[model samples]
Target: MPLALNTLKRPGPLSKGGMRITALGGLGEVGRNMTVFEHAGKLMIVDCGVLFPEEHQPGIDVILPDFTSIRDRLDDIECIVLTHGHEDHIGGVPYLLKERADIPVIGSELTLAFITAKLKEHRITPTTIQVEAGDRRSVGPFDLEFVAVNHSIPDGLAVAIRTKAGTVLHTGDFKMDQFPLDDRITDLRAFARLGEEGVDLFMTDSTNAEVPGFTISERDLTPAIDKVFTTSPRRIIVSSFASHVHRIQQVLDAAHANGRKVAFVGRSMVRNMGIARDLGYLNIPKGLVVDFRKIQSMPEHKITLVCTGSQGEPMAALARMANGDHQIRVGEGDTVLLASSLIPGNETAIYGIINKLTDLGANIVHKGNAKVHVSGHASAGELVYCYNIVRPKNVMPVHGESKHLHANAELARRTGVPEDRIMVVADGVTVDLVKGRAKVSGKVEAGLVYVDGQTIGAATEDTLAERRLLSGGGVVTVVALLDPKTNQPVEPLEFLTKGFVHDDRTFAGAEAQVNKALKRAKDDKIDDIGALEEIIVDAVSSTLRRTYRREPVVMAVVVDA
Candidate 1:
């Protein structure tokens, strides 16, 4: 169970020969996955990633893991071990590299290629070390071994870190799909071998812990996808994550079988697919894939478009098309396949896109109505199997929300792990392992760092609150030209309102209240512009609350005339 938040305190210095583990993100939530491990005064990080902003976080491009706790210790970091190439698993690497550019980044070949491509966009040339499944390397005091894991994306890995303190096997977002499109399966044999060597703490993905039974194989979707291609009367548009090479491969095959040329839309979809194809992860038949621009000229039944925005990102191709803002128009008889699951917190946006596309006469097919997507994380049955196979002394669930973590902890409990031995922690909660026992140590500063356009960490909670207030209640600006001697209004108070109301006359009561407050200030011989501005703000705020029953952002500007 998770420790009570009120009881958590700052952890003291690490004991000699003990390992400290702290999650900067990816606990109590789904994305921004990062964990810091300390042994022998050296730190090793795994999976620095980003969280997509929710609807409430206006103007935020992405949310990064707070690096404040380790900002001063960047030089002590040995390397960042990445498990996969998904955006949520590797998106924040470039931002972290900006702090220390020379930190060695270790991952599989495809993982390294994806990060390299992403870092190149940020103009930071990273120092990367490529390693694959079954590869072992010693960095600082940590002995790391990578194990192959099947996920939605190709080349996913699970890393086992061994040190004098203990061994921690972290399953980085995996599922036991016996038959994957790439023919790669999770290596349970390696897991059994590691179990024989004694795993002190097993940190596993908790994404699908709430889900019962094993996840269906990716191959099961092939029949459904082929059916979509065969039955669709017009152009077929399939939307999924850019890094989902397996899903894209299936789409390409389906399109080719149906005599339709595929075209990739969106910049990320084009770029990542090109990299995957070049690296032999994605197979494209000759003359099967065509350019998006060229696909426009093809007959509707002979063309297929694959794009991003399965989660309904406003800027992605699918969302733009749904809004009728893109070059590709969604008309009657067009089939739109959202070949991805609805990520939590994105339901409203996705449904909004679906509504828009439906209004445009497009036929929508999603996981809710069809078998177009399957999760990449292991479910309850798989988790139970892994727990029994590894037989770790302790278990800590990672990469999920609060319920998922607890559900995963229960799975461990059912597999004979003591309830007290399971650690369900949140971001910033510290855990220490010594002599093969893991316990919650303390807490640190783990908060959200938002990226807004060119600015990073500049957008704070208060800023988002103000944005929400403005977006919901609107803004009212009151400019008062006051007399220099008496602090009385030299001209009638000018009021400007936005998002609050359509007419300026709605602020007539607020103007009157401001004038009355200014008169009282003048009677008190208050001449300071700052003091008068405060009085004006207070009066307008109170009046708006009384009259309009709304509290908009009230901006008071006082100038001496």
Candidate 2:
């Protein structure tokens, strides 16, 4: 969706003591879609979510928005209103709940079911209230109305948060699918009713704004996936996001139609879909689902495996199967259907998975080759449809990168909204709305807090940057004994390199550069431990670049003897 980020127009001021909307995350990026609504000192947080890390964010398992904006004012928060159960929308709930367990969470019944399962992992039992579209809840100064929105995940809502400042409609990731899979189309009637009442500010999802025409409905994927089940005479494995219960529902239906027994492979796929089935969101025939271990006993043509790792996550079930390391056998006469959108930046790994499957003589079915996947987000045509329906005074795009946001703003302008009425901003920047006008007021700390294993907020920006450097160019550690008198190394440096040096010649060459750096440090009479280490790092880096054209992370660990 990143076509361009051309600067548009800035916004003017709102009235005094107006409402402040700050996106702690989900402004400039795809994931971590959290926003704070402040009115008269009371706060309402919408969708505290998380962003999954890419290659650049090394060692980070997940990234949560910095809660510095609300950390000190935890008591000011009323309740967190969730839109859907997708990880990017609901993943950070447990992290937020860890701060204030008393804060109530409201979402659709299926959405709450997913949250409950996620929170159980952290030993947290949240104060949750289930509601459907048309359910109204007054939390402090804000009166919130949850309107159903058709997303990839079922039970998604577009919240109409009303305050004294005005009414703001937040369209959490949505699409205009007239024939939705579950028949729960985005409540356009409710949106039209709210639009008639006058929507002051509209925060819409801009994920697919750059794509022309409307997004294909979830219903569109059924025939394609059913074709895979009907045509394949071997075991069929479908890979997709576990949270896409609608897709899984279709997969189960297809298996039943083809007389195939279903088997869930990934931990999250099993846990989440099981929760979905129990909550009546997903329906399966009696004895339709068999344990993955029991699949061996069944005929290859009678088995259907649904799994996670559609993005080619290394340890995910699909990736493991592609590597032939999985317990489930996928070889000749097997079919692998990639029934999920190929996320940006995951092409290399995804292709690697496809190559492995093809090499193993399995049939590969994907969105590129077949109409097996459709985006959950609205495209340009659909965004225009929403804009025409809910004519707000001011329009701001959220849930995408800078270009996506800018593209959405232009789309709003084409809908007769003036350039000045369109606001395009990034995370941490606050938008103050009052009396049907909006403007950038101030900023907050919306930096990422990376989750590495069980360590949250322990890794800093510099630490991650170093990790990225190490990942690409590798890391070199020089351990030597330093003389306390001169802060000079008294012995030969021990060079330990990882992902850096290839042969003994490279290590031997680096050793000479290290010795020269030590000698220079001693001659300079530098005694400060920190400063001396910096010199070694600089010298070794220069050598690595000059000789090998590598910019590796060089560590100097000179122990005082």
Candidate 3:
């Protein structure tokens, strides 16, 4: 008898150019994660994310991928499928929808709910389609299957994308846990069945590639949290990701174990808890959890607050608490636990909150000092285990930095997968899958889009140069009142300096020098007005640079008649 064909079906048009995949983001580093798959003339985006701006970025909010390459070809975008509801995976939707709003969005019910909330926040009503585990949907020419996978959050899934080329399984961030709080584990049976049927290309998570062993179960954190609630002498306040349902459950369990009522803070956190409870995904013991507003009415010893703003994003509930602007303040004898790992590029912001909390006489507990946080990523050994499970012809690491991807590739090599078979990809680099083998065909136009003030624009080398200048030097503005009749000065020439001075003191001698330089330029009075303006501005800039040893962007404003 012939063996059963237990593989995901490959619906075709994939061979039109074969199967090609590209990283829109989540390649060189984590955050701002987007991946594009091109099969049979159609493009499918896996996730869209936003990268947090660095410290040097004065007023920038988030960075997203420049979709100029595919924006024109958006008609080919069959559907956008989400793996989970993490910000790095879902945050870019508002930006993406702002540009292209008609595309269909497919994800689990919970994932769709989160996306719905995001759209409502942006006042956009997008067309969203909800799917479930083991369900198959057709987006353009591709047949996609959603396989349940466990992660820090519930409803995480691995997508089995089947095209004319072959079966490509993209595992969004996942780990194997037999005892998940939700009792849902990675569909190993499905994966093994796919392995038996043959997996064409495997794009897997590499965030925890360097660490060995499987990730600890979410249930395991309960005991440690139990210790905190039962042992601590002060009022307990826990801050974690709003979407971490398991952690929320653990916090509630620990609170109940310690005989305390729980109050959830942060609007997003509160809404998510209510949704999870309503959806039956999370159940906090009845009569044990109360609204935050009611917490103030209860005794501090009987209350525990689960909150948001773990990353210290401005205006989050925790930041408000740190500033004492929230309804509940963390005064003396309070203990705050940062129960989530710090996402990268947010250390300064997180530490700022930590400092404020500490200054308010609140005991701050972090990763090591307190048993608060554990990573959601699969470490090195776990990577190896997954590789061993779904032995594939080609391996591509996604969702981590270059260092992490390279490390995972090395682990793959140790597991006897040829180093040549491992491909480390960056944004816009395309890998063509031909006959179940993979190789980089060429590059696509991909770049970062920066959000400055209320305007959105691309982050080019010139923009980066300007950012560097702003960081290293200061800015100066030169304003002059000119006669309407002659396009000549009617008032004294003056320069204003900012971001390069003491708050209370200005260099009197420097101001005099600037005045003298402007007067010299005016005396020269070149016949050409444009030439004269350039000369005067140059003089002021040059004098300030020599005097203050700093270069300020000189803005020349001439009052002309």
Candidate 4:
């Protein structure tokens, strides 16, 4: 069972020879994955990433893990260990680097390449140490070992942190795909060796804990993709994550077999693929890939466009095509393949895009209708296998929501790991491992830091609430010019509204009510413009609520004449 939130207290100082673990993000949520490990007065971070904004978080570009707990200890960080190159696993590195740019970053070649390219876009050159699976390094007081893991993207890894206190094996998003396209499998031999070495705390990915059986291999998607290519008569447009190298490779193979030239549409898709190709992770046939501009001249049947926006992001190329706002427009007889899973909270947007594309006379193919995508995380059966193999003293599930965490914890329990040995907790919850025993210690500051445009950490919950009010209830502004001496209106009160009501005349009675309230305030000797403005706001709000049963954003501006 997870630790109770009410019982959580501020973490006390670390005891001698004890190690502290705190997650800044990626608990009870799916993104912004970060965790801080502290031992011997030093810290080592694992996976600093970003969470894409949901519909409720309007105008937000991305949500980052709050760095309040570590902002003061930036110099104490030895390095950041990245597991993969997915946005949810590496997107926030640039923001974190802006605080202190010299921190060393460690990852596989492709992972380093992705972050390096991303950091270059931010105009910050990062100090990176490239290491592959089986490489071990000792930084500060932490002994780190990287193990190969099979995920949606190539060059993924799972890291083992060995220290004087204990050993923690963090399985960054992974699955047991026996027949991966690249012929690389999850290294269970290394995991068994780590288990023999006695892993004290196992932090495993819990994203697919509720799912049953093993995840299907990437090679299994070949037939479905081939079918899509064979049946589609006109232009075929495939959408997927920019970081999914295996998926893109499969699409390339399918397009090649069907004798169609492929063009990558979105800037991110083009850039990331170029990086993957340069790193030898993506194998492209010569003359099979064409420029997007050149595809316009090719026959629709011979052209295949692979782009981003499988999640229905409005600004992505696929969504723009659905909205008829992109140069590569979808029309009759076109086949649109959404080759990605629907991320939670993105169902509405995805369905809306599907509807729009269907209305445009395009045949839609998705996971529901075809086997075009598979998860990158281990399922329940695989988790059980991992637990029985590793046989750790304690377990802490990461990279999932509350139910997923609980489900993963349950799997551990059934695998003979004592129920009390499982620590299921949310973000910021601290755990301490000492003498081979791990338990919840306390909590820290792990709030969502939002990014809006070029500003970071400026968009707060109150700002989102105000935006929701404006978007849902509209806004009503009451401008009152009051006498400087008596706080009486020097001129008739003016009401300006946007998205509040269709007709300004609808507020005629509201004007009378505000005037009466102002007169009463004046008769009561209320000379302060601020006080009078409150009176006007209360009167207007009451009138609107009583008449229309609606509560809009009522603003009163008081001016001294």
* Candidate lDDT values, in order: 0.93, 0.86, 0.79, 0.93
Question: Per-residue lDDT tens digits of candidate 3, residues 1-561?
Answer: 111223313222334558888888998778888888887777899988788776766567788876876888888888889999988899888888887888889898888888888789889898998988899988888999989998989999999988878888899988887788888988988887777777778888988887777777777777677888887776898899888888888888788888898888877887777888888888878899876678778877887888888888777888999998987788888889888987767899999999999999998888858666667787777778777878877888898887788888888778777766778867777778988778776666667788876778745557666667666766666676755444456665666766655342334455455456545655766335566566556766676678667676666766564
The pairs that clash in candidate 2 are none
lDDT of 1 by residue, 1-561 (tens): 647965899999998999999999999888999999999999999999999999999999999999999999999999999999999889999999999999999999889999999999999999999998999999999999999999999999999999999999999999999999999999999999999999999999999999999999999999999999999999998999999999999999999898999999988899999999999999999999988889899999998999999998888999999989999999999999999998788899999999999999999999988888899889999999999999999999999998899999999999999988999999999999988888998999999999999999999999999999899888888898888776677778888778777465677787777878878887888877888888998998898889878989888998778
* Residue runs of model 1 more than 4 Å from their true location after superposition: 502-505, 522-525
Model 4: per-residue Cα lDDT over 94-154, one tens digit each: 9999999999999999999999999999999999999989999999999999999999999
TM-score of each: 0.98, 0.92, 0.88, 0.98
Off by over 4 Å in 4: none
Tens digits of per-residue lDDT for model 2, 1-561: 122223323323435669989898998888998999888888898998888877677777889988987799999998899999999889999999999997999899988998999999999999998888988988898998989899999899999998889999999999989899889888889888988999999999999999999888777778888899889988898998989988888888999988999999888999998998888888988999989898879888898899998987888898898887988768998999998886666788899999999999999999899998899999999899889988989988999988899899989999988788888887887788877788776666778899999999999989988888878888888786887776556776677888985676665666676667766766887667787777777877787788889898889886888
RMSD for each model, in Å, please? 1.3, 3.3, 6.2, 1.4
User: Candidate 2 — worst ten consecutive residues by lDDT sum?
Assistant: 1-10
Which is better, 1 or 3, measured by lDDT? 1
What TM-score does candidate 2 get on C-alpha atoms? 0.92
Which candidate model has the greater TM-score, 1 or 2?
Answer: 1
